[model samples]
Target: MNAFKSKTEFAQTSVFKLPHSFLNFDNFVSVMTRAHLDRAYWNTLLIIVAAVIGNVALGTMVAYVLGRFEFRLKKLIMGTYIALSFVPMITTQVATFTVVKNLHLYNTLWAAIVLNLGTSVLQLFIYLQFLRNIPRELDEAAMMEGASLFRIYRTIIFPLLTPATATIIIIKTINIYNDMFTPYLYMPAQKLTVVSTSLMNFSSERSTEWEMMSAAILMIMVPIIVLYLFFQKYVFAGIVNGAVK
Candidate 1:
């Protein structure tokens, strides 16, 4: 409702009544025209796509190798992952920033993409959980038919992980979309703005344009809300299924 209010109306009071102009799109217009959200949208989309793909490929591969095969130090690796996950990410930002700087990824979209590209323990655990339910008989049967390990993974394993993949994609997309810290810290350029940082346009050292800011907030929120509303069932199902076994 604040999105439809004039500056004066918005400044006056918080009322339960209707907005000053229910049909007024001026705030939305101002946000679109003045803010860099159009460019931000594309930048965000690119990062989300790259990050999701990298995560899924690497995550599934790691889970497959660990879940299907017995290897030396396997327990050590899994333990390391669990231990590292307990460390707060904030504590490592200083070192991470230096590495990104050394790699010359500062102020580039690649910085965000590369930083978010890794598979978290959550994803690994989830994939491993699903993999447990898959029968080793499938692998043996495929091997008897002359199917290579890679072919079996690509055709049989990956295809069956669709529900888990969908869950990861949606979760990762939302996380990247809502994250302002990485983009703001790594890619501060105006052209590299993302939806998370686009709303900064309506703010200033002196005062904020609450009406326009409100409109921008609504716009930024709608996509994520719509996405979750549509795919929430998959998320719930994946989590519940993984947890069950």
Candidate 2:
């Protein structure tokens, strides 16, 4: 069959090309050095870490208040968050960019990090799901023992939210890692290239070298693949647990 022959030919070509392409570290090194990717890696790491912390802390607190407390404006607040989630991020890019420029954060790593610090509605919903599974009796008991709200969150609620937190971290890490648009738009300096934007170096207006491009893609993919493999169980666990309630 033609299909079978085509598949065979593709496999053979991949086997022949990929081995040589992947093994050639010169291209990888050249790309990294030329793009100043070492600095980029540090910048990306800082942004991811800082944004994850901010997202988790803020998201958890909001979910905790919305889930565990009874306030007059609760429904309105929840509705606002749900409504905002329906708005597409791309539609607001011009306004967002304007705000970033006005704030004097353009072309700075903090700009990316600050933009990502907002509470993720999905993460908040996940936290709310996990929060529902935790009985109110724990809070009551902790309160009876003179534990402040902060103490309860830190000592009890926070520990129980670990699985969900891990899931959020993994998801956000991948999102931030593959995000080329924000880094390219906000941090255009050649020295500020993240992994995603650095891949642009492989192609141009005239021609694209497929082998080098393939190599660069694999290099970009390796870290994410390794992270997923390592933390896959937590991701599944969070999904399963969150689905239960």
Candidate 3:
């Protein structure tokens, strides 16, 4: 309702009078044109594609190794991941920022992509769970057919992991779309703004354009809501399959 309302009317209208507020599309037009949301949308799409691909590849490889092969340091490596997950991200910002600067990733879209590339512990566990259900007989049969480990993974394992991959893609896309801190902190260039930060056009330290902000919020929300509604079954299936055995 506020998205269609004039600023003055939005500010003065009573909560009970919301249904009677004037409908105006000026807020939507202003946010879309003046706020430069188009560029942010494209930038976010690039980051999401890169980040999700990296995550799926890296997570699958790690899960393949840990699930299929026996290694001396396997427990230690997993323990490290679990331990690090407990550390609050805010507590490590200084070190993380310095590393990003050292690698010269700061202020670039690569910074967001690289930072988000690594698989989280939860992702690792989910992938591992799926790997566990895959039969060793399949690997053995592939090996008998002169298939290398890489071939087995690419043609055999990857195809079977599609459900889990879909779940991860949906979840990761939503996360990257909604994330503001990474882009705001590392990529401060006005041209690098993402959808999460584009709403700042309606905000100032002194006061905010509530009507425009409402419209912007709606714009930002629709994609994620639609995405989840379409793919929610995969998410539930992945979680249940990963947890059951």
Candidate 4:
């Protein structure tokens, strides 16, 4: 068929031109050395680790308190969180940028990390759903064993929230990894480039080199792909358990 022949010709001309493109370490080295991607990788890793820890710890603690305890302003607080979720983040960019600027964190990595630490409503909701299934009797039992509130949370509630934690980590990892706009906007310095923004180096006003771009993309994808492969079971388990009961 003409279609088959065209496909074969295209593949031969394009992919086979640099048969070693995917396997070549030279492109990777070029990207890393030329762009100073080693520094960018470190910067990105630090941001992801800090952001995930803050998001998980803060989100989990808030969810635990909101789910387990009844307070006067519980409804109001929950309503506020839910309402804020409905407001698109893009709408608040101006205000957020202003705060970051005033804090003198505009070009710093902390700006990205701090802004992202705010608890995600979706993650909070998932935690609350999982919490509903965990009997309060466990807390009572632990308390009878001389466990304080913090002790109960640390030993009992926190351990039981593993699946939800894993889910949040996986989700947050992907989001933070692929997020180009925030890093681009907040980290304008060449040295502050993250993986997503670093890809821009392959493009220019005159022409874009598709071959190098593909190579760079594959390099960037390797870490996330490996991460998902390892944690996929936990992700599925978390989704199901969080949603079902």
Residue pairs in steric clash, candidate 1?
A: none
The residue-by-residue lDDT of candidate 4 on 35-147, one tens digit each, is 67788789889999999999998988999899999999999999999899899889999999999999999999998899889897788888988888789999999888999
Q: Estimate each model's TM-score.
A: 0.96, 0.88, 0.96, 0.88
* Candidate 2 local Cα displacement, residue 153, angstroms: 1.3
Q: Which candidate is the best by lDDT?
A: 1
Stretches of candidate 4 off by over 4 Å are: 1-12, 15-24
**lDDT (C-alpha) at residue 213 in model 4:** 66
Tens digits of per-residue lDDT, candidate 2, 1-245, equal 11112223434665343242223356566656765667777888988999889988988888889999999999999888889999998899999999999999999988889888888667777888899989999999999999999899989998899889999899889999989889988989876778888778768999764545655677678889999999999888777776654
Model 1 earns a TM-score of 0.96
Give per-residue CA lDDT, model 1, range 56-174, as digits (tens).
Answer: 99989999999999999899989998899999988999999999999999999999999998888888878998998889899999999999999999989999899999999998999
Model 2 vs. true fold: TM: 0.88
Model 4, position 193, has a per-residue lDDT of: 91
- Per lDDT, what order, best first? 1, 3, 4, 2
Q: In lDDT terms, how accurate is model 2?
A: 0.80
Per residue, candidate 3 scores C-alpha lDDT tens digits across 151-177 of: 999998888888889988987898899
lDDT per prediction? Answer: 0.91, 0.80, 0.88, 0.83
- lDDT assessment of candidate 1: 0.91
